[model samples]
Target: MKEIAIAGAGPMGLLLAIRLKQLGYENITLVDARAGTYTRPGILNASIFEELTQLIGLPVDFSDSYHLKDVERSLYKIAESLNIKIMKANFTGFEGKALRVEDEHHDIHILPCDLAIDATGSRRALVNEINRLFPDAFSVQPIADPSHKKHLMAYVKVEEKTDSDPPSTPAPYGFDFMVQKLEELRAMGWKGFVEPGFYALPLAKNKTCFYVEIPENLDASQHEKWLKTVVAFHTGKDNFDYTLLPASRKYGSKPRFLTFIVDPHQVNEAFFQHAQFPCVIPVGDAQIEPDYRIGIGIKSGAYRIKCLLDAMVLEKDQEFHIDFEKYQKELAAAMQMHAAALSKFYQEKQRSYEHYANLLSIYETVIASASMSKQKELQPSFAELIQAYAQSLYDAGNNALESILTSSGDIPLDKHGLIADEKKLEDAIARLIDAYKYAQGDLYTMASLKLNEIAHLYEKLADVFIQRGAYGSSLKCYEKANMIIEKILKDRAESVLIKYKHTQTLHKASRYEDMYDMACQTLSEIKNIGMDPEEKKKFTYKLELNKALALLHILHIRKDLEERDYYEDECNKAIKHVKSSPYLKDKHLLQLTKLLGEIPIESMCNILKDGDKSDLAADKSKRR
Candidate 1:
């Protein structure tokens, strides 16, 4: 049996052991430097539940322990359900495929294994040992923001409650409330607010965990006063009492210092100046130290374990060199994707907060006015509030567009002769006009601009076609525009803008069949595009008039009965295409509906009973 020794009894180490065991590697040992399990009041976020579930085949249940459940409880439940028994011991040192651990009696136990995983977390001792033993394999760097450390502190105690009392105490835990309180404190010359009412497990009946986070720079003397105020705010004086423990004092120290480093980037800079190992893998915080507030450390640790497992599985069959190269590439890709996602999330959040702040200011002003006797008869209604919110969104969109235009230098621009420069300038101007129109909910303006741009592009193509004396090809461009305008108006029946374009394009295209085809295709395309009833009516009139003329022309050309019958079949197919379209307006589509209705009832019933084979053949021809 393949034996693996994993250091650290934390979630990452435990999860790795469980996964390895499931993969048929059962002889495993989990070692922690501490003598026993370390207990501290820490919260876990719900994001890691999926990862936990995948590692161990179990669904997390949070209803048992905590009254106020969040992400943390979800994590704890998953961890508890793993079923893999944990053994506590101190990790003294390590040798090749062997580790030394001290038991309860202080007797050192040496165990041999196939592999030794350094899941000893962010300990400098383990890192230093690894670097010294394999100098060419490991690298270390200082964590950033080393000075801005603050400890996470929480208090837990049991209290007595009557049967009629609520299961969980009502408390405000949102960051907004904390920020507001902090601002209020800042007004009174205090650096930070005493954040209160953080929810936790109801350890016993009438007992609740009263949690508070204290920053490193808080005044020492004011700490007690702050705690008192927090306790009073969360639990009323009559209902519950408090017990502050000694362990809570340990959390009064500075928080962990974190560093954001890219290992491949370091390698490129030759920071691994004297590395010699076959594979020098850095996992968890050693790889990249993100902010603790984001709870990325746990996520990074779990991800690293999964990556290691993947590499190990691949290496079993593949050459060591190939496996190492593939692993490094995958690692780099994961890091880049993570960085991009994190950056985008924070950027969007900052923008959202700014928008919210502006809305709040406006609301405050309106409320103040309503409170005054000067505005006794005037008060903003619910609809007015909704309108204000929508306007804010529009304003934000406009601001975003303006920022892109002014600051984004990546957008191309030409600077040659006056005529060429003016054309490029016009294109840029048109783009900005479209953006502004979209922000202002001016759909007509957007449609008009798009059609105009398409026309100009097609006009240039037509000019090239004319120079080559390809009259048919030149006419196709005008025909294409005519079709587009027809569909636009058909769909947007009430739109004056689309009607004008449709009329103009239809006037330009000469061929009768081309005009008819354009109208048919336009009707089909309009099913996909947006349009109103009036726009639909205007376009429908244009389409039917063109179709009638085209059918008559085809009849005049094909004088023989058989040939005339073929042309009639083609016209019917075109009408069928418009009727069958998904976007066809039921009311406006009634033109084709009525035409089908006008056919003899017996013939219509026969056609419906025995589907048109000729129509099917025509569809197959179109596909080809």
Candidate 2:
């Protein structure tokens, strides 16, 4: 039997010990400073619960999440019962066969170890020591872009003042049961609170653990200022106490405030290869840092344990050889791929949140202004309809944003994987469109709401689609939004702006004819209208230039002598307008004009072919 020592008796270490024993590996020891008494709370999904229950031959009760202490205590009993030695000691470091350890009494000792596995989450004690002492044993690399701005998450105990005494027992876990309990509290006049990007996990008595996600750029050094700024910005209220819990822990009986910087980094394969000690390997968070924001750590840890067993360990009574090279290659590739994908996931989530914030702010402002303003009695029904529409808009927008944000990325898998939440973004878009159709109001308010609010919503949706590489979807959204803008147009400038925006989308979607028609129609519509000379000149220059380019694209697809003549004329018109505007630079303009004066059929085809290749490359890049 191999003398194996697993450090850190967390879920990963305990599970690994049980599996190795079942595989007929004896003389295995599990060590941790906490000695199975854990306090930090962690989320447990269905996958982890099922795995633990099957491994131990006992039901591991399911819950939305659990405190690390509860999971450790339960797993500790199974580990001990299986004849796995459990030690109340800390893994200090290792030197070949000599493993340095510190007992609970703080006395140092060295234990013989043929192999060592580090399951210590995030602290990465053993891995760090090996790299520091040996200098060439391993490497640390950021899974996500290190240059990305790090966010903050603060987990604090929130104590609410209640007239009733504290409960004798702990809180329940079932979802339906918790819902019923919350309803009962609300029925008895208990008014709870809500804040953006925050959630509450119930604890014993009237206290709950509020996981407050601090937005970027907030000064976390000043606790009060950060909390107040977050609340006021989200709720438009300065009554800090009423909105958010007190920043100080003095008010709570169970005072707990733990803050962590949300930065995801990982160790390279050299850390696992153990060039110094080939028998040494790291597991769980020590291998790849978990994205705790979406609760992927525990579940991923379970997956990693099973994968490690499958790849390295064999059935009972078989050759007890480990394929170290095979596992290292698998893990390294997974880490690199997961890191690249996770970076994009966070970027998309940040954008979605920003879009959500804008929509929420607009919705709240509209509702607030409508409530305070005195409108004609005849318009009361219309005002109510508009308010109802705003509420629907907020609901659908939240659903769309949450669908992507709640998704968890799979780090252990060879390929990138993401599990989305309940509703798809397409569903939310459908619901919003349905609500908009019924939002009837007086002319001015309706037009303002449609143009400024609804149209902008579609534009934001288009931006998201563009980010997702759904060019056709983005083009449709932009075209529909431009139609909304046209319906509510109040001036010649508005007409010109709508056409410019629509033609831009058409150009991106490669609808050259539609782009040409839009520019032509807008030029005709604004021909007789009075406008500022400078503004008109700028719009005219862009519209004619785009119109000329659209015609060039059409001529590339097929020879068109008449259209080619029209294209040259349009280019001259663009030059004339651009020259009139002293603000417009003609440095690059001269180069573009020089190219457009050509009449070669072969050149246009080559340019068109190159454009197509670039667009395909862009599509591939966006998908990544």
lDDT values for all models = 0.46, 0.58
Expressed as tens digits, the lDDT of each residue in 1-624 for candidate 2 is: 257888888888988898888777787888887766655544444466676787667765533455655677777777877889888899887766757889979998777776788888778878887778768566766777532333333443333354432222223333333333333323332222112244445545444554444434444465444543443333333332332334444334322454556677676653344445536678877877766555666666666666677666653654355766676666666666556666766654443333433433443444445434422321443344344455455456545544544234111111222223323544544444444454444433543443445456556666666677667877776776676666555354655765677787788888988988988887776776578877787777777767766766666665745656656556456545554646555453443433343433433323333444354445456657
**Candidate 1 — which residues are off by over 4 angstroms?**
1-3, 33-38, 45-54, 58-63, 66-87, 92-114, 132-151, 156-213, 219-221, 227-300, 314-322, 336-624
The per-prediction tally of clashing pairs is: 20, 0
Quote the positional error of residue 347 for candidate 2 in Å. Answer: 3.3
lDDT of 2: 0.58
The 10 consecutive residues of candidate 2 with the worst lDDT sum are: 409-418
Give candidate 2's TM-score: 0.49
**How many backbone clashes can be found in candidate 2?**
0
What tens-digit string does per-residue lDDT give for candidate 1 at 413-445?
Answer: 235211223344344444433333333345445
RMSD of each: 18.6, 16.8
